[model samples]
Target chain A: MSTATETPAQHGLAAHSHGAGTKSVKGALDRFASFDVADHSVPHGREEEWRFVPMSRLRGLHDDAALDGSDYTVAVDVDPRVTATSVGADDSRKGSSTYVPVDRPSARAWAAAEKTFTVDIPRDEIIERPSVIRLTGTSADRGAAGHLVITAGRHSKSVVVIEYDGSSSFVENVEVVAEDGAELTVVAVQDWADDAVHLAHHHVHVGRDATVKHAVITFGGDLVRNGTTLNYAGPGGDATLLGLYYADAGQFIENRLVVDHNTPNAKSDVEYKGALQGKSAHAVWVGDVLIRKEATGINTYELNRNLVLTDGARADSVPNLEIETGEIEGAGHASATGRFDDEQLFYLRARGIPEDLARKLVVRGFFASLINRIGVPEIKDRLMTTVERELAVAEELAAEAAGDA
Target chain B: MSTLEIRDLHVSVETENGPVQILHGVNLTVNSGQTHAIMGPNGSGKSTLAYALAGHPKYTVTSGSLTLDGEDLLEMTPDERARAGMFLAMQYPVEVPGVSVSNFLRSAKTAIDGEAPKLRTWVKDVKTAMDNLRIDPEFSERDLNTGFSGGEKKRHEILQLELLNPTFAVLDETDSGLDIDALRIVSDGVNRFSSGGDKGVLLITHYTRILRYIKPDFVHVFVGGKVAEEGGPELAEKLEEHGYADYVGEGAAV
Candidate 1:
């Protein structure tokens, strides 16, 4: 029941001030003055989705030094059929493409300074090779923020891969638009170093008859939060969101996804799988689907599954479906968080397979079906690399567990 | 000589109804270079015998001694049993989705031998084994038993047997769900693995179809979780002709 026009102070900004700022920050503050970032605040452990996540790890004060020029770099690999362009927040000709600054006197101060980068795909273009954006951040003292915007023209087909790696803690925001008759695939891989803390927010808009597939792989980071929101604006549009995460000892990864089926004949499917090992390793998967009153004949399904590898490790999974209209075609959601299946493990071990290798095999098998659904080869390769690395880490942790036992 | 001996093996499983005995007073022995076939009706503890021998956790031995080549088998863990030269071709092989068959076989080989296999020899040996089993070389790259058809899973099990080269193997009803062609191929792989002098096999099955390919030196009929009858390969033909009606009657009395 909350409107977008509500003021930040009204939504829990009493702790901070909307003081005077630079012209650019002032404009954003004025435009979104009624928007309350606290509306999005989910108190740690109080919300079911954040139960197993170590939010305390990210609640401490972060260094605010600006990143040095050499500390961050952006590289892109695009298909021959598609052209890539980097547009800053000031680009005006691209209507409705203005970047929203995260830092300001607003309630969303924790996410401040996160900027958006934009990419445009022309009409009728079929991008065969996946476009890869590699962001390498090497700052040791200061945090960084980056933004991305992707637009697929009508009847166009394209793939985009965004890789995030840096030394410092930071936040990122990505926005994607798929016009009518367009098909887009966006794959994000976060392979930051062990010391880095990353928070990413992704917003996607799907037009009529458009198709969008978004996949994320998280294997590295001390603490990471990747949030995705998909809004189907036009009827007959389809959206799919898939994610895989592996976190070992001392690593915390949280994923939150919302699919808003606002129009009729729209379909959305989401599947996220994760594995956690080590003493304090933790993971969370939150899947929310909203079927509005006008969205009749909607088909929405979501599934979240997590595997806990050790005794102290934890996983939280929440799949919620809100159906405003009972006229939908089909809607369902499922959530499961469980320790490794001992019966399955024994079944494998009985085959003469070692216990360690057997557990790894089962975990890999659990994610293979979803990984195969990723049509892009580059993204698939990247996912495999992340999976292998996580498996290696799991093995090391298992060895340590054995040593302790 | 390599041999697997089970001395008065009694196995039970923990269930909601409390502990229920599955195998009661079972004893058998299979010497090196010999094939032994065990046949029984469903619920007669055929699978339990196999699982107990493989050291499955669910089957706890109340009283038993399993030894492989004079080494205490029950004293070691399942992995240790495999490393100690005991292999189990599972009745229902678990599907491993992400690990490739090649990777799984290599890891098993390394674990068994306590060292990594020489890459060149390992690859050659794997390729030869795959060729012998009529399996496509590309299958090695596929996930272990993931998405495999019933026949393909059985063939993959045989491939493991061929690659691991354990001294003693327990083939647990591998021909259950296979078509005739797949059954023949799987039987061929088992026969190939048993061709060497140091290999021993305890083949457990409900049907006598597999025995037509790999003849058994001895056939034992299991009833009431105990060996009710023991004879040469002729006993298999006798059971195939006449079902386990008489055995069931005798088991009821006992």
Candidate 2:
């Protein structure tokens, strides 16, 4: 009878203003090192960072094998304000932007690169249309390596989309730089062939008061490992990192991200969602945030959720936050991994939606929120189609498994 | 035009130990255009009847005969039963995280109708139905039942009833969590469905407050999984004044 506004809090967790991040410091502090390749060696699956990875299947990307082949072709749809050029290793922008090797795989990618593919957005210029860069592999057996540098000049605004396709053995290093007061959006899509193997590391640096929206969408690979690090150089910077991945039968897809809040008055948010299906399908997400003692007045939160669609599919999720000082805006995280919700299924079925279609609706709905955050229609539509295809395959596999039983 | 016949229905659920019986030899008949209200106390198998008719897998019908116009209902799956024009408004509507209300409604309608609804008119039809239920237009884009208030959930159920237009509906305690205004709106929606004189409603409730607005044509007092008594609307009036104390003696049977 009365008009009352009941707006529930966005997150179900209780809001704590003081010492919120300190409470998450339960275990002994985890270690983080500077971006030095020599400090790391070939992993034998025993290290904390490399424990979840299957080392035997890496195809020597972990070791110092010569990346001696040009098995992929690079194509770009150029914008007037944006230009892509192949430069020698000595180009000022080649290694000047956020270029640092975090681990051995990245260092190997650096040492074996033939040339650098560099795309630069000039200072104070805004590009209305998005630029597209596509890499297509020539074959599956040949091993390939490459390096890429993308930079947005001071006060410039632009969007760059990088897409990967075809099948091959690949290792690559990527560097992204957002200068002071610039706004940049980078969307990297890994849509490989069924036999492709890709290992990559992406390092991003944000300048004073800059804004960067970075998204990684991974699908269609036998094995893929992607690592990203975001470090702010000045105060008032904002970064939004999003990832969506789908892993099918006998596939491994993992994303590891670290957001280092080293400056005061900055914000960072990370959200990643994945769905796994079929036998031996595996997906993993690891998020780590470190706030230095000087990084006061910071707001950060991360959420990761996984949906396992069929039997034998596995999902691993871990979120860790390390804060040196509790004097900050707020910090928290949430993670969950579960199968299809029976209550939701029954609710939809009671509405006369057949069980199969009801399941599709529920799965698609799980990704709807993250997909909308992408803010680009073409990518959103294409991702929806990809999700639908994954659901179909999962359904067929479930049927076959049931038949065998 | 249609008749939902339930005869000697017995249902049970599986617990950690073993099978546990819930309903024993219950019988009722709801013909088209009739509003029959079943009033009972908690744990008296009132909600079990609603779930049993909806073909919930957890509820095993050991012995019973449920028919929708002479077709076997007990043999059908939950979705099949819904497709056969049976509806059950749950007491606690589940929250689906990612599915939007508009998409879910469209998918359900298409599944039941055997074809996709005409795009141009379907949008208008949904708008009209939502407007009639006093539901905001933006709710169509939100996740299905997630983060919705109690009143909002009840109104959404009624919205589906108006749009889906089922032949028979089993509403289980739809008025429990609703405010007075929401109760009236939900009652009006049910009234509109039966006003067509081709749809039947089985209203399961614990209070007589909703009956003041719904105005059932028949009232049945349920106790111990059995229909203790039945009569015209006057039965509800009598029970409202006195209570089920006359029929249910001191925790006699369950």
Candidate 3:
């Protein structure tokens, strides 16, 4: 309880303090970015980033797994104004974004993917409909890797949605870049099958005066770990990151994010909420925001909230903020894990709402605002229905377990 | 007519030290078209009796029984009690984010009536009710009780009272935080509910300000977790002028 009053620096890793003009240094949890897999060591479930993740269930994604299998297919739907092309691995547009893989799986995926799917939005054009990318896995035994680069041309506005489903052992790297004065929104929906194991790293770079919105909604998959990073390429960039995941029985879901404010006068906000139910259902959220010495006048806040619906389920939330200078506008972080509130249920029941229906309402209310921010009506409606289904299934399982007892 | 009877009810709540009894033997019977006000000083267990009637899990009924029309209320869960025509306007309404007031009202109505309401008539009823209560048209679109002010929360509670149309209502300190205007509005709402001549009410309060608006047929002076005296409307005016000093000792009301 005493830790509630402690600052983020005391709760998480703290770095060295130096005067102005001092050379920059990396702190703990700040892994170096590289294209070579050798630059990153294989995780053994003991590292700071991989500690909360179940390493055994990752299916060698964090180790030396072969990533050349062609058991998955990719489909893209884009308007004639936009260009959707699959270029060679060594194309010039591959590494246009200010991002590099900071983990072994990401670096391995970057090296092993033979084709780079690129989506380019023309300059100053506002796309009427979102470009859709759908990936389906055919085999759970075979491993696959993929790389996707989406570039929003200068002052252009567009939204790209990526959907993943079916069973497979997969790793991928997604690069997003918003050029100067552009507005871009990228939504990734991970509705994989029960046997699927996936590891995804999404890196975003915001240019001068640009705005970027990234949303992640995960509903299925036996083991899923998503790592997202945000960096400002120039000054006055704005970024918003939103995530919502529901982990059912025997499901493991992890979302780790890093927001690096390297340029001045930039603004960023991160919000991720999750719900877990049933035995051995685990959910994890790790948010880190770093404000460098030169990054003045920046405003940033990160929030992570989790709701545990039943007994034997677990949720881990860690929010870390490192400030190198106090000249910024403001920076803060918040993390909280609350159980299904009995008081809420009691209030509803007193109003003639049954216990089951009341529980569904509360959970739906918990995720409503965040899901609405996805800005895609079809996706939002589908996700809402999926959440309702999940709650019903969870209740049925709880009833069965009680009957057995 | 329906009758709610509480016979020698003894209730206790769990604390760190163990069970602490809050309500001694309390006997009261409320019939349809009758309004009863329970007035007491702080720590007189006024809220406990209200919670005990609403079937809150925190308050344990150690002795006696509660029934509506000879049906045992003790055996019914909170929702069952509600479906049996019981409603409680909580002192502090819980905030449920993302659930619109319209949706919640519809769901509760469905649950109570065992079927969904007619869309056109229900919508018109809700609008008329909200308009009569002086609530904004946009109020029903907002999340239930989220970011609502004290007065707004009180009005919303009364709104539920009218929409649910229960046979009996137990209002616990509904007037504690309301201002004069909001109090009048809420009192009016309660008046409208009981005017149907087939509903019962157990209004609990610590002040007589709300009594001036909604007249009670019976007023019971509660002290030390038991009823000290029972009377009609004039008793409320008397207490308003003299205060609870006669019921409890000097400075004991604190």
Candidate 4:
């Protein structure tokens, strides 16, 4: 249960996506070189990069449609030490220092965002509490666009949380930069109202000897497709990307990550776990890691595990590792998707636990390891309560199915 | 006094060929304050009897009657059976990862007893029990049986027997993978469970070494899915010396 912030030195650095036993498409990152909307066209289902996504569900996010209406809003809560400023096109944090859009949706969203919300940690400043940014979208039947840029000054440390709620079609780009020797923890909590659709491009760059912890937690949404890319600016940098998601009926949650090991002696560990229940609940996790020939002594391992809790729920996990020079440290990836373990159920039931309770215990235990690793106590408590609520709904569905039989 | 009565129990399991019979007309009775050891050779359906009694779904009791204190045990689920004072120490214990031993034991205790254990005394009880079984205190923090050695798993079984304290327990080869020290420790735990003169034990094994520590009042030689010979402690010594070669052939009285 040791968290990324606690042992930041190990399980650190680089970004990636991997397929367990199949060849992974490496062109996704290559296509990410341009921020101009004209450079990246709308994706059709035929392309390898856009096949799994339901293009119609994007709600015109990919067609360069004008972001209409003003139903969604952002609320910032932070200490005075950290400043949240509204910057323009000439802002210092803009330009190539940030990530280029890999798809039409991101490019259009970036172009449409009139104001870029920027949060900066003062040089060598340490903030004790995490800053919270709440994005609440009204069910106004309109699409909205936004952009956020977060940067940590030299030798500074802080946690920034971006939470999404309510219902609307939303597309945004978030860029994070950790300066040399700085530590940053960015938590993206997408607990949206059920009808919400969010497409986000999250890019993070870690500096020399710096550590960055990124957490992606998604529970509610019609569709949430997150592509989070990581790259190290200097050697000895560390990046730990953690993700947890739960998808229910008619919900789709996808996490695509690319951790680039371009700097020597940098390390990274990627762990993403998800659960799916109810009819048509789908979860997809794609982990790809690319290590350059000069990136020697890189210790990186990516893993994705999914638990399918009921009938008609699907979990797809792919972990791919591409290493140019195998001479440095160990590099590997693994992914697994399975239903509840029968042997574990039997063991619990044989010891006097009822079937429903046993199933809940098994699932809770399956995710408990990662849940316990979260650094924030309030978030941890809230997640557990949410998990219990989901289990209760699962129990009702199971009872109904049994009754129909 | 409580009593577990099994009569003419016939059991079968589903396979590729469909429903292969495993138990054929086996009869046994265990009363309070009694220790009965059922010894058998390999493929003699010994484990099947234990699993059948525990109400495993795979092993269907095709024809039989089982009762506990005049109550129909066959109608109850496995958890209900456990709550009704029946315990089975499995031959191969299943591992539960990410679930700490402390939480697991307390969960079972709470479920069976229908109440949460008192935190202070329950912790003490678990610590003392683990100490008596020679288990490290850190074991309580580890996942249940995951990566545990054979001896540790066996001792953990006995540990449950001691803590759960069921009126009747069927120990299936609890001595198979133990060193001398672990064997004595586990047997001692079992002896402590039945020492009150109010519990019953149905110890199943192929070897006689465990009998030295937990003496059985009755010994039954099982073959071809049923008991072929029944006697006292001396029968165990006889079988240990003569072996079960004579019990496997046809025309051997059931």
Candidate 5:
């Protein structure tokens, strides 16, 4: 895969079907890429990518504000086969995945960070327990820049979970590389406080015959945007990307992802589910899959589902699939945004479950399958507890809206 | 003994045009230790009566007095009505994905009993009930009604009828889509519930096949939202022979 996009017009795929005029003029992959912040321009709300996001809520992460705040602390707990350390920007392994920043906030985050947190899994070792990393922001008064790199050696298997909480205006760029025959799982949970603003970009490079499972759980934060890019480094590379998010009243959560199938005999599956409640609760999901001319016998499917609980709550889902070659096995995409199912609620309530508890059960069931597929036992229970707490708050907000109406 | 009295009940459902009345001044009484079979042709409002009795939001009781032992049932929500000893085995049970059958049953039992059941006895009771119904033990772990066949869904409804043990059960076309074996199994389960000798049953169906298994003391022929004729079990046998042509006109008989 080419790392530089000096002549993006010539490099972009031509005449592909999806995201025609909604995203950038070209395909999603041909977007300007660079490490220097000056190369990318600040986005106004009118831009297709920024249309769904409120630019004012970014806290100047996209513009000239300094991202040098140190009001945060990081803690890491790793399995015996893994090592966690911080390296200077000049570390040889920093950009080993050959991924450059795609957006202004991503570029700014890369240019502003002096050090990167790195996690390494040695070759041929199977990790028994997942490595856990926790980053907590002490205050939201100032913004911060963050960078992380996770590399899995050949034939090894490991799971890494990074959890974020507290409050801050944070921008981050994450790079993941899996070597041949490696199996890697990475989960990034954004559980920030209601006052926090977060913008993150995750670029994953899948190696030959390797498998990677990546999940993002976004439940809190005043405004959060997560953009992920998946690139296949060799044939038979398989990637499963899953996400679960809930946006409450006055909150904005957006997830944008693209999968580039530039290699043959590769597979990719993306599924994201979200629920929104209360006034002005907004959740947006944009999924793009591109099957290049060289990507033959490839199989890919992407699905997005959103449930809107009450009036004035909105969910936007857009799925685009572009296949330049018909020689691939199969390619399909489905997107659905629907209101809370009244028939399911009535069924539960008629079975002697009270209305409130019935609603809770429906919402819980909505996120259960996705959470179970995360496959991390330690985090599953904690995630369910968090879901219940969020449901309590959502119910209160719904009741308040009902009373006002 | 408990008595459910539906006196001159009227119901209407909202459509795109306006409110269309489905049930017009229907009267019936179900007493403990007695089974009343309400046989009707298609679109005769038999299902509407079941839903209205269970307080489904889609049906409006424009004017009616629905009472269980002299207490107004219209004032209660669906859950409260279940706690008051009323159950409706829906013909088309909605599938609730990601909620296991075991959890859903336990929750409904808790709500009806006002407390959680003893874990030991509850598990044993559920196991015994499921075993009698010939349901696989692993079925309890699967999502409720999701991907279930027609027979499995009907059997699950009967299982709830046996476990919840409500005072009155309104079985709405429970025998509609079942084969002979499944029909017999579901009827046996219903008979087990009614065999307690203190439960009232209002069995609603378009056919008399299930009446042969669980005989009803009274048979009411429903036509055009009201009872066209009322008699003993002999009425069901007669309808089986003539097929409702005597009541609904030869042109309308199925």
Candidate 6:
């Protein structure tokens, strides 16, 4: 993996060249320069983690700038107790905020156009209730991009839901931080309107003894790429990543997750499940866990399971574990992808369930185990509704195929 | 007349031994509001009969004619058969993980009845049915058969039978895994459905304990995919008392 550090001049970007309104851009550039971006783009296929991912997807995105703002209206059906506060550029510094600029010029320009949003759970405040933060883009003429930063303070616990719903094809980056002794549950639902292209990056940092549970549900967009990276920075910290995704009829959804155990006694559990249907619908899940040598007492496990709903659709799953030390209590990973089980289908059908309903039943059941793990009734209910809606769409597509046949 | 007529029913399944015939030349008639018990040893094709009647794709009826109330039953799909007033309370009910029993039952009722039942009436009906079976109303919210005890699964099957109100029900060994109390509750559910005066039941079982609660009007000993003996409910008692030793010889003959 190339870890080369590139100066702004090498990338053909002059400092403060974009004009007066670009002060945030300059600050972003200064902050991002401290991190290694060139090495992050290493297309190393020798490692098992990047074996199945089509690195070619990153081809045209290398020099893309931040997308411009679109006339999109975000639709939100959230709990009444939860407020959707929009954090404009002026309000960014009021709370604990971390910012990372995109290396690509296009993503940088897009982020510069749309104001950033921040969701904050006050310090030491425990809101046993759940809340949602929805972002919708409606730009039809051009691509869009923005940044979301969330913070959970010390001794505080709460659930935050972030949904991206819109008509624009764009890129998104979300960075989150959980301070010491804080607990945060974040659910991201990406159900963009058709004709949208999206690439999203989620970076999470868990402080010492803190806990973060994150889940992603993807069911829309033309070409969607979701990348999540979590670093357990504090001792005794834990992170759990659970995701459910479904694609059908010409939709493509790809997810890549990397969990880094940087501190000792840090634990991580990752489970992602998905289903694909219709002709040429593709669903992919790539999970990688790296247990650093110094993280001796770290315990981690990951599992990715995919179900193919049709003969023409395909699912790809890759789960990798790199353990530097074996002193951990337990560590393992499993990945499997296959078509529907005939035995299970027959089992339901034999009970007087129609083939269509039986298929829906089985697919719902496949995700039931994960839904139970969500631990939030509001989010769980919404997940069920979204899953059922997707199934309904799949059935319609299947009916059309049958009609064509 | 409410009658389940199976004429020259032949069924086969694809197995390691190639296409194996499980049901051969089976013939039977079950009348309305009457209980009929089918007793057979393991691998005697009792469950195959249930699957065939329920239109399971694996149980291909190569040569058979099944009619319910004079309508061609075998010609319909499983869901269509269910809508046509046939219910199969499976011996091993499938564990549907996410679908609650209440939701599944409501959907099944809508499918069978061709319309959604009224909310007020539906709730009242379900509550009354659950009360009669001595089942907690909270069971309705639980996922269908998912993590349910064996006895709970049996009771759930009966709950479906009562709520769906099918004209003819094929209970495929509903008593196989039930204990004494569970057997009584399950039998009580079946009795409530049968007492409706418009329903007919075909109870398949290996034990006669359930029959003690929901008495059968007729008993047919199924062996080698054929009814080897037919008698009154006394045959069930006889099998329970003396075992199937005397009938196995006759069952082996064509």
Best by TM-score: 3
How many residue pairs in model 4 have overlapping backbones? 21
Please tell me the interface RMSD, in Å, for model 6.
2.5
lDDT per residue, candidate 5, B177-230, as tens digits?
999999999999999999966999999999999998999999999887778789
Give lDDT tens digits, candidate 5, residues A325-350: 65666676777888767788888878
User: Per-residue lDDT for A1-405 in model 1, tens only?
Assistant: 122123332221111112221222333223332234444434445544445656566533222334222368789777766666665545542324223323221123224433446677889998787888888878635555665778899999988888888675666667788989999999888888888877776778898999999988888889888778777767999999989888888888988876767789998989898888888888888776676668888777788888887778888776665545556666666677887777667756654567877777678777775787766765666577677777777778778878998
Fnat of candidate 3, please? 0.82
DockQ of predicted candidate 5: 0.49
**On residues A1-405, what C-alpha lDDT tens digit does candidate 4 reach at each position?**
122223323332223322421133345334456768888867877777677788888777778556755787789999899998778855767643358777788887777877788988998998978898888998738778888899999999898988999997888889999999999988899999888999998998989999998889998899999999998999999999999999898898999998888899898989898888899998889888877767887788888888887799988887766655545666766788888887788778888888877777788887776666557665777877887787777778888889999
Docking class of 4: acceptable
Task: Tell me which of candidates 1 and 4 scores higher on lDDT.
Answer: 4
Compose the digit string of candidate 4's lDDT tens values, residues B137-157. 999988889899998999999
Q: State the lDDT at B171 in candidate 6.
A: 94
- Please report the TM-score between candidate 6 and the true structure: 0.74
Between candidates 1 and 6, the DockQ winner? 1
Give lDDT: candidate 5, residue A267: 94
Tell me how far the alpha carbon of residue A346 in candidate 2 is from the true structure, in angstroms, after superposition.
Answer: 2.4
Q: Which candidate's DockQ is highest?
A: 3
Candidate 3 Cα errors over 4 Å, as ranges: A1-31, A90-97, A180-182, A206-211, A233-238, A261-269, A291-312, A321-339, A367-369, B15-18, B40-44, B221-224, B228-254
Docking level of model 5: acceptable
User: What digit string (tens of lDDT, one per residue) describes model 3 on residues A1-405?
Assistant: 112123335322223223311233365335677999998989898888899888988878778878888888888898889998889999887888867888899999999999999999999999979999999998988779998999999999999999999988989999999999999999999999999999999999999999999999999999999999999989999999999999998999999999988999999999999989988999999987888878888888889989987788999998877767667776777788988777888889999899889988888899997887667776778888888898887778779878999
